[model samples]
Target: MTTDTASPIPSDAEQFGKPLQGWRLRLYTIIFEADTRAGKLFDVVLIAAILLSVAVVMLDSVEALHQRHGRWFDVLEWCFTLLFTIEYIARLVCVRRPWRYARSFFGVIDLLAILPAYLAALVPELHLLMDVRILRLLRIFRVFKLTEYAIEYRLLSRALANSRRKILIFLSFVLMVVLVLGTLMYVVEGPEHGYANIPTSVYWAITTLTTVGFGDITPQTNAGRFIASLMMLLGWGTLAVPTGIVTAEMTSMRRRPVTTRTCHACLTEDQAADANYCRHCGAKLSPYQYDREEEQPVRR
Candidate 1:
């Protein structure tokens, strides 16, 4: 008999591999897994609520709208907060390791979605923090389960990670160029021309190099103008170098096929389509099937 030598990746549930059953299993499937009809529906509704809640927060920020419909916005905000509170609690209740999920990236996002509203209630000054509720929109990625997007996100993330050192070195070079240019401009333009000091000149150098050209600072001398032109030309090339590095890394890496099929045991995603075990926890995977008519996963 042939033997598979692949190792299981470590996950939150690696130590406890027992699969969930009964209603907890059903709830987990609905709330965490996005492959089934019910799961998809739950995710769609959750995403809609998230979007609406974020919109309410945004509209509430408008001074005119706040004056006119502040009370209604407050009510709607609480309603969405309560709804999310229930959902967050459900997620905690359903997961085998509640703390694990609670501490996970999305878990913290889920909590943040509800906490700011309550905090705002206790301390009116904190009302501005309600804007953080917009982070809940990040859930759209998990909910939509677009395989192509998932693959691309992984690719981009890996490319960036692999090229971080090179990018860092490039940024250091840019920083040095900015510092040197800023010092030169300060010396050339002096205080009367608004290039008062090294720090202020460095700020100008950054703005000029990025092409932001805020217009608050101006080069009074021909040398200063020439330096600004050099910085602008250098900026264009500097910006493209990082992109090329990441693109090369991405192109060199192999793309692997993945699915939205989630393991009930560990909650690790991006499982292979035909795999019977969780690649992260080695738990037996539940049978995989999706509605053929709804094969295209929802996009954000």
Candidate 2:
């Protein structure tokens, strides 16, 4: 008797457990998936709009420019805000669970991109927050579909995560050193030398230890100067400690090859190079293809 193997099941579904179809499916494909030409174009245009909006907000801060082009800047700001508002709504409408996505990192960022404009009348200072749209530019990494860059970013992120504990301990030690040195300076230099109190002295200690000598405060006494010299020397070595820790962690990691293929079910990217299913959602992945054109040899 001949036996047949069962075909893989499709797991793409909405929050209500229905498969996405029609316009919603098409919109999701274009908005969430960066693998297609239309999707890439959308992302590029969106990124450009974000950058221009941020520039408008920044230029508005300059008194001279604001006075000269204030009216034009206001119109441009509202135009960009309206565009982002529609994009944000489309993202919500296309996703399976709107509430879930609204609570996600990118979703929050998308909302922030348009919120400042609406609230600009209530609090004029909030208009400056429109610059947060610059964060949306991170989408560029996925839009280009550069597998190597994505892998490197993942590697660096992993190294940093693994080194977090060591880095935290190093920071704690630095904090204690600053506290002790700051108190000692306050006692030796006293209020007359600008080491007015423990907190002020701690600020000086931080600036000195970071080698950022603001020159607003100084150690007048010989004992305080000696301590400052020691802190300065210590800063040089401190700067390299975190770098070495992260580098060592990165070197010990085994780099896995990954693809820019994004999972349709959950919209996760960075799937394993040979994966047939989404690692995050177990959805059967569609055929993976390179977006870039392969070089062809010259014809004889």
- Compose the digit string of candidate 2's lDDT tens values, residues 1-300: 955222322222333122256787778768765665677788678767766777777777777997999999889977987897898898788777788777855566777666666765566664476643343333232222222123355567667777787899999999999999999999999999998899999999999999999999999989999999999999999889999998887776644243558776665666775678999889987664442223233222
**Top TM-score prediction, candidate number:** 1
Error of 2 at 73 (Å): 2.0
* TM-score for all models, in order of appearance: 0.68, 0.67
Model 1 lDDT tens row, 40-133: 7886787678777767777777879989999998889789889989998987887667887778666777776777667656666544665543
How many backbone clashes can be found in candidate 2? Answer: 0
Instruction: Assess the local accuracy of residue 39 in candidate 2 as a C-alpha lDDT between 0 and 100.
Output: 79
Clashing pairs in 2: none
Model 2 accuracy (lDDT, Cα): 0.72
